[model samples]
Target: MWGRVRKSWSTVRDAFRTERDTGRQARSHNLFEAAAAYVSACAEDDQERIEEAAGWVSPEALSFGVNELACRAVIALARERDESPRAVARDLLGLPAA
Candidate 1:
């Protein structure tokens, strides 16, 4: 009887684990989709929309930290452009840089 109970509990535990992992993966995928959409939308527009993108971002997934870092990365990639933070911050927000 004890052996049967243990097996049942083990099965339940594995099911719960699988459910949790699935939820996490789904959430990650959704976030990636949203971020990609945001980038695409922003890129299609002109520099005038840069400031607007800062609010379009999902603060929960990509915090201000990630945004700032990504901005710096862009600056690095544009080694010859000598872009300014304020000028590029809007594009860094996900919009196309001016």
Candidate 2:
């Protein structure tokens, strides 16, 4: 799973480099937009969309955005399930409760 994410990040970085060399303007997507699209594309196993979304922001920015998304998701799920954020995250990963 991590390998796939790293490979995608590398691909995005290379694409961004090439675009920068060509003096092309970056896409209008902000960090949140890029994160949402990237995650949705990954969930759907859509490589093209993943690449496109990944190109919208720097890898670091995308990483931060994804982390933010994850935190928000966990909080929302915890609230809905009446559980702590840690419990919700562990449950999502199939870990036994503490």
Stretches of candidate 1 exceeding 4 Å from the true structure: 1-27, 30-33, 45-58, 63-69, 80-98
Steric clash pairs (candidate 1): none
Q: What is the C-alpha lDDT of each candidate?
A: 0.50, 0.85
Model 1 RMSD to the real structure? 12.1
Q: Write the per-residue lDDT of candidate 2 for residues 1-98, one digit (tens) a residue.
A: 99999999998765433332236764366788889999999999999999988887788888888999999999999999999999999999999998
lDDT per residue as tens, model 1, 1-98: 99999999987544322221344552222333334444655668644443333334344543443455466567775564676755665764676756
Cα deviation of 65 in candidate 2 (Å)? Answer: 0.2
Report the CA-based lDDT of candidate 1 relative to the real structure: 0.50
Error of 2 at 90 (Å): 0.3
